[model samples]
Target: MSEKKFTKIDCKELKLGMRFSAPVFFDDGENMFLGEEKAVKNYHINAIQRWKIDYLLTYGHLVTDGKTAAPDSIYMLEDLEEVEEA
Candidate 1:
Protein backbone atom coordinates (compact mmCIF):
# COMPACT_ATOMS: atom_id res chain seq x y z
CA MET A 1 0.00 0.00 0.00
CA SER A 2 1.25 3.50 -0.91
CA GLU A 3 0.06 5.85 1.84
CA LYS A 4 -3.61 5.06 1.37
CA LYS A 5 -6.05 7.36 3.13
CA PHE A 6 -8.06 5.95 6.05
CA THR A 7 -11.54 7.27 5.49
CA LYS A 8 -14.49 6.91 7.84
CA ILE A 9 -16.92 4.21 6.74
CA ASP A 10 -20.42 5.29 5.74
CA CYS A 11 -22.94 3.26 7.72
CA LYS A 12 -25.75 3.77 5.20
CA GLU A 13 -23.68 2.53 2.29
CA LEU A 14 -22.61 -0.47 4.37
CA LYS A 15 -24.72 -3.60 4.14
CA LEU A 16 -25.20 -6.59 6.43
CA GLY A 17 -22.26 -8.63 5.22
CA MET A 18 -19.08 -7.34 3.55
CA ARG A 19 -15.49 -8.56 3.66
CA PHE A 20 -12.56 -6.37 4.77
CA SER A 21 -9.09 -6.84 6.25
CA ALA A 22 -7.12 -4.83 8.78
CA PRO A 23 -3.88 -4.99 10.81
CA VAL A 24 -5.03 -4.83 14.41
CA PHE A 25 -6.91 -7.31 16.60
CA PHE A 26 -10.43 -6.91 17.86
CA ASP A 27 -11.46 -6.73 21.53
CA ASP A 28 -11.64 -10.46 21.70
CA GLY A 29 -8.13 -11.92 21.57
CA GLU A 30 -8.99 -15.57 21.06
CA ASN A 31 -11.54 -14.96 18.30
CA MET A 32 -9.43 -13.14 15.70
CA PHE A 33 -10.49 -15.17 12.73
CA LEU A 34 -12.96 -12.53 11.44
CA GLY A 35 -15.89 -10.27 12.34
CA GLU A 36 -18.89 -8.60 10.69
CA GLU A 37 -20.35 -5.06 10.61
CA LYS A 38 -23.32 -5.41 12.91
CA ALA A 39 -25.20 -2.20 13.71
CA VAL A 40 -22.90 0.32 12.04
CA LYS A 41 -24.58 3.42 13.42
CA ASN A 42 -24.62 2.11 16.97
CA TYR A 43 -20.98 1.06 16.69
CA HIS A 44 -19.91 4.40 15.19
CA ILE A 45 -21.69 6.52 17.76
CA ASN A 46 -20.36 4.44 20.64
CA ALA A 47 -16.83 4.38 19.18
CA ILE A 48 -16.31 8.12 19.48
CA GLN A 49 -13.63 9.25 21.99
CA ARG A 50 -13.01 5.63 22.88
CA TRP A 51 -10.59 3.19 21.26
CA LYS A 52 -10.14 5.67 18.38
CA ILE A 53 -9.87 3.33 15.42
CA ASP A 54 -9.52 5.19 12.09
CA TYR A 55 -11.24 2.60 9.94
CA LEU A 56 -13.33 -0.59 10.08
CA LEU A 57 -13.73 -3.76 7.96
CA THR A 58 -16.37 -6.49 7.77
CA TYR A 59 -14.84 -9.88 8.56
CA GLY A 60 -17.37 -12.16 6.86
CA HIS A 61 -20.89 -13.58 6.90
CA LEU A 62 -22.92 -14.26 10.01
CA VAL A 63 -24.29 -17.74 10.70
CA THR A 64 -28.03 -17.46 10.32
CA ASP A 65 -30.87 -19.90 9.85
CA GLY A 66 -32.68 -17.60 7.38
CA LYS A 67 -32.82 -13.99 8.57
CA THR A 68 -29.84 -11.80 7.61
CA ALA A 69 -27.88 -10.09 10.37
CA ALA A 70 -25.51 -7.13 10.45
CA PRO A 71 -21.78 -7.64 10.65
CA ASP A 72 -19.55 -7.28 13.69
CA SER A 73 -18.54 -3.76 14.77
CA ILE A 74 -14.98 -4.52 15.78
CA TYR A 75 -12.88 -1.95 13.91
CA MET A 76 -9.19 -2.67 13.70
CA LEU A 77 -6.36 -0.52 12.30
CA GLU A 78 -5.10 -1.85 8.98
CA ASP A 79 -1.45 -1.43 8.09
CA LEU A 80 -0.96 -0.82 4.38
CA GLU A 81 1.64 -3.01 2.70
CA GLU A 82 2.96 -2.36 -0.80
CA VAL A 83 3.08 -5.35 -3.12
CA GLU A 84 5.20 -5.13 -6.24
CA GLU A 85 3.96 -6.70 -9.46
CA ALA A 86 5.89 -9.73 -10.51
Candidate 2:
Protein backbone atom coordinates (compact mmCIF):
# COMPACT_ATOMS: atom_id res chain seq x y z
CA MET A 1 0.00 0.00 0.00
CA SER A 2 1.26 3.49 -0.85
CA GLU A 3 0.38 6.82 0.76
CA LYS A 4 1.01 10.49 -0.13
CA LYS A 5 0.67 13.47 2.18
CA PHE A 6 -1.14 16.63 1.12
CA THR A 7 -1.10 20.00 2.88
CA LYS A 8 -3.73 21.42 0.59
CA ILE A 9 -7.38 20.74 0.52
CA ASP A 10 -8.25 18.10 -2.07
CA CYS A 11 -4.64 17.68 -3.04
CA LYS A 12 -4.16 16.84 -6.71
CA GLU A 13 -2.44 13.61 -5.78
CA LEU A 14 -5.77 11.75 -5.44
CA LYS A 15 -6.69 9.76 -8.48
CA LEU A 16 -9.40 7.54 -9.83
CA GLY A 17 -9.77 3.91 -8.74
CA MET A 18 -7.49 4.61 -5.81
CA ARG A 19 -8.88 3.86 -2.37
CA PHE A 20 -9.08 6.58 0.36
CA SER A 21 -9.79 6.37 4.05
CA ALA A 22 -10.53 9.67 5.78
CA PRO A 23 -12.07 10.34 9.16
CA VAL A 24 -14.33 13.38 9.04
CA PHE A 25 -16.94 15.27 11.02
CA PHE A 26 -20.59 15.26 10.00
CA ASP A 27 -23.80 16.77 11.34
CA ASP A 28 -24.48 13.43 12.89
CA GLY A 29 -20.92 13.22 14.10
CA GLU A 30 -17.83 11.56 12.59
CA ASN A 31 -17.24 8.76 10.08
CA MET A 32 -14.69 7.26 7.74
CA PHE A 33 -14.52 6.05 4.11
CA LEU A 34 -12.45 3.42 2.39
CA GLY A 35 -13.98 3.61 -1.07
CA GLU A 36 -13.20 4.41 -4.68
CA GLU A 37 -15.12 6.42 -7.26
CA LYS A 38 -17.28 4.56 -9.76
CA ALA A 39 -18.24 7.68 -11.74
CA VAL A 40 -17.90 11.44 -11.93
CA LYS A 41 -20.39 12.28 -9.18
CA ASN A 42 -20.00 9.25 -6.97
CA TYR A 43 -17.19 10.80 -4.99
CA HIS A 44 -19.21 13.93 -4.18
CA ILE A 45 -22.13 12.00 -2.80
CA ASN A 46 -19.90 9.46 -1.13
CA ALA A 47 -17.97 12.17 0.71
CA ILE A 48 -21.08 14.06 1.80
CA GLN A 49 -22.74 10.91 3.00
CA ARG A 50 -19.77 9.72 5.01
CA TRP A 51 -19.13 13.13 6.55
CA LYS A 52 -19.78 16.85 6.32
CA ILE A 53 -17.78 17.16 3.13
CA ASP A 54 -18.08 20.22 0.96
CA TYR A 55 -16.65 19.74 -2.53
CA LEU A 56 -15.75 23.43 -2.70
CA LEU A 57 -13.12 23.02 0.04
CA THR A 58 -11.67 19.87 -1.49
CA TYR A 59 -9.90 19.08 -4.74
CA GLY A 60 -8.57 15.73 -5.97
CA HIS A 61 -7.62 14.29 -9.35
CA LEU A 62 -7.98 10.92 -10.99
CA VAL A 63 -5.49 8.19 -10.24
CA THR A 64 -4.19 6.49 -13.35
CA ASP A 65 -5.48 2.91 -13.59
CA GLY A 66 -4.06 1.76 -16.91
CA LYS A 67 -6.92 -0.77 -17.13
CA THR A 68 -10.12 0.49 -15.53
CA ALA A 69 -12.30 3.58 -14.86
CA ALA A 70 -11.12 6.64 -12.94
CA PRO A 71 -12.53 8.50 -9.92
CA ASP A 72 -13.35 12.15 -9.24
CA SER A 73 -12.48 13.82 -5.92
CA ILE A 74 -10.54 13.15 -2.71
CA TYR A 75 -11.82 14.86 0.44
CA MET A 76 -9.33 16.43 2.83
CA LEU A 77 -9.37 16.41 6.62
CA GLU A 78 -7.78 18.88 9.05
CA ASP A 79 -4.75 16.92 10.31
CA LEU A 80 -4.57 14.34 7.58
CA GLU A 81 -2.01 14.17 4.84
CA GLU A 82 -1.46 11.42 2.28
CA VAL A 83 1.88 9.66 2.45
CA GLU A 84 3.41 7.66 -0.40
CA GLU A 85 5.28 4.87 1.32
CA ALA A 86 5.16 1.59 -0.49
Candidate 3:
Protein backbone atom coordinates (compact mmCIF):
# COMPACT_ATOMS: atom_id res chain seq x y z
CA MET A 1 0.00 0.00 0.00
CA SER A 2 1.21 3.51 -0.69
CA GLU A 3 1.85 5.59 2.38
CA LYS A 4 -0.13 8.76 2.61
CA LYS A 5 1.51 12.08 3.40
CA PHE A 6 0.21 15.52 4.19
CA THR A 7 1.68 18.99 3.95
CA LYS A 8 0.81 22.55 4.84
CA ILE A 9 0.83 24.80 1.82
CA ASP A 10 0.05 28.38 1.01
CA CYS A 11 -3.54 28.69 -0.16
CA LYS A 12 -2.26 30.31 -3.31
CA GLU A 13 -0.85 26.95 -4.30
CA LEU A 14 -4.28 25.35 -4.24
CA LYS A 15 -5.60 24.23 -7.63
CA LEU A 16 -8.71 22.54 -8.92
CA GLY A 17 -8.56 18.76 -8.52
CA MET A 18 -6.16 18.86 -5.57
CA ARG A 19 -7.48 16.76 -2.72
CA PHE A 20 -7.56 17.59 0.96
CA SER A 21 -6.22 15.10 3.45
CA ALA A 22 -8.07 16.78 6.29
CA PRO A 23 -10.94 19.14 6.81
CA VAL A 24 -9.92 22.73 6.34
CA PHE A 25 -10.84 25.09 9.16
CA PHE A 26 -11.14 28.76 9.70
CA ASP A 27 -8.33 30.43 11.58
CA ASP A 28 -10.86 30.72 14.38
CA GLY A 29 -11.04 26.93 14.57
CA GLU A 30 -14.37 26.45 12.86
CA ASN A 31 -14.71 23.42 10.63
CA MET A 32 -14.85 24.31 6.97
CA PHE A 33 -14.98 20.83 5.47
CA LEU A 34 -16.18 17.46 6.63
CA GLY A 35 -15.53 15.28 3.63
CA GLU A 36 -12.76 12.79 2.99
CA GLU A 37 -10.34 13.69 0.23
CA LYS A 38 -12.45 16.59 -0.87
CA ALA A 39 -11.55 17.86 -4.30
CA VAL A 40 -10.78 21.56 -4.59
CA LYS A 41 -13.23 23.86 -6.37
CA ASN A 42 -13.22 27.44 -7.52
CA TYR A 43 -15.64 28.60 -4.84
CA HIS A 44 -13.48 26.93 -2.27
CA ILE A 45 -10.53 28.86 -3.57
CA ASN A 46 -12.55 32.05 -3.43
CA ALA A 47 -13.53 31.33 0.13
CA ILE A 48 -9.92 30.78 1.10
CA GLN A 49 -9.04 34.14 -0.34
CA ARG A 50 -12.05 35.90 1.11
CA TRP A 51 -11.31 34.45 4.53
CA LYS A 52 -7.64 35.31 4.18
CA ILE A 53 -6.53 31.77 4.92
CA ASP A 54 -2.81 31.76 4.16
CA TYR A 55 -2.15 28.05 4.47
CA LEU A 56 -3.98 24.74 4.53
CA LEU A 57 -3.21 21.05 4.97
CA THR A 58 -3.63 18.86 1.92
CA TYR A 59 -2.48 15.58 0.49
CA GLY A 60 1.16 15.78 -0.55
CA HIS A 61 0.58 14.02 -3.82
CA LEU A 62 -0.74 16.22 -6.58
CA VAL A 63 -2.45 13.33 -8.35
CA THR A 64 -4.62 10.62 -6.81
CA ASP A 65 -3.33 7.66 -8.73
CA GLY A 66 -2.96 5.42 -5.69
CA LYS A 67 0.80 5.89 -5.62
CA THR A 68 3.02 7.98 -3.39
CA ALA A 69 4.51 11.09 -4.93
CA ALA A 70 6.16 14.25 -3.69
CA PRO A 71 4.14 17.42 -3.34
CA ASP A 72 4.73 20.22 -5.80
CA SER A 73 8.10 21.71 -4.86
CA ILE A 74 7.78 24.94 -6.75
CA TYR A 75 6.79 27.98 -4.75
CA MET A 76 4.89 30.50 -6.83
CA LEU A 77 5.60 33.48 -4.61
CA GLU A 78 9.32 32.85 -4.61
CA ASP A 79 9.29 32.59 -8.38
CA LEU A 80 7.36 35.86 -8.64
CA GLU A 81 9.89 37.58 -6.43
CA GLU A 82 12.76 36.31 -8.57
CA VAL A 83 11.03 37.62 -11.67
CA GLU A 84 10.44 41.02 -10.06
CA GLU A 85 14.08 41.32 -9.15
CA ALA A 86 15.22 40.59 -12.69
lDDT of each: 0.37, 0.36, 0.59
What would the per-residue lDDT of candidate 1 be over residues 1-86, giving only the tens digit for each residue?
67433334443444444334432223333323233323334444355326554444333332344544333422221212222322
Ranking by TM-score: 3, 2, 1
| Cα shift from native, residue 30, model 3 (Å) | 5.3
Residue pairs in clash, model 3: none
lDDT of candidate 3 over 14-79, digit per residue (tens): 776666556654444445542445566667788888878887654434446554322333334656
Report the candidate with higher TM-score, 1 versus 3.
Answer: 3
lDDT of 3 at 46: 85
Higher-ranked by lDDT: 1 or 2: 1
Q: For every model shown, what is its TM-score relative to the native structure?
A: 0.24, 0.24, 0.49
Backbone clash count, each prediction separately: 9, 13, 0
After superposition on all CA atoms, how large is the RMSD of candidate 2? 12.5
Instruction: Provide the lowest-lDDT 10-residue window in model 2.
Output: 23-32
Alpha-carbon RMSD, each predicted model: 13.0, 12.5, 13.7
Error of 1 at 60 (Å): 14
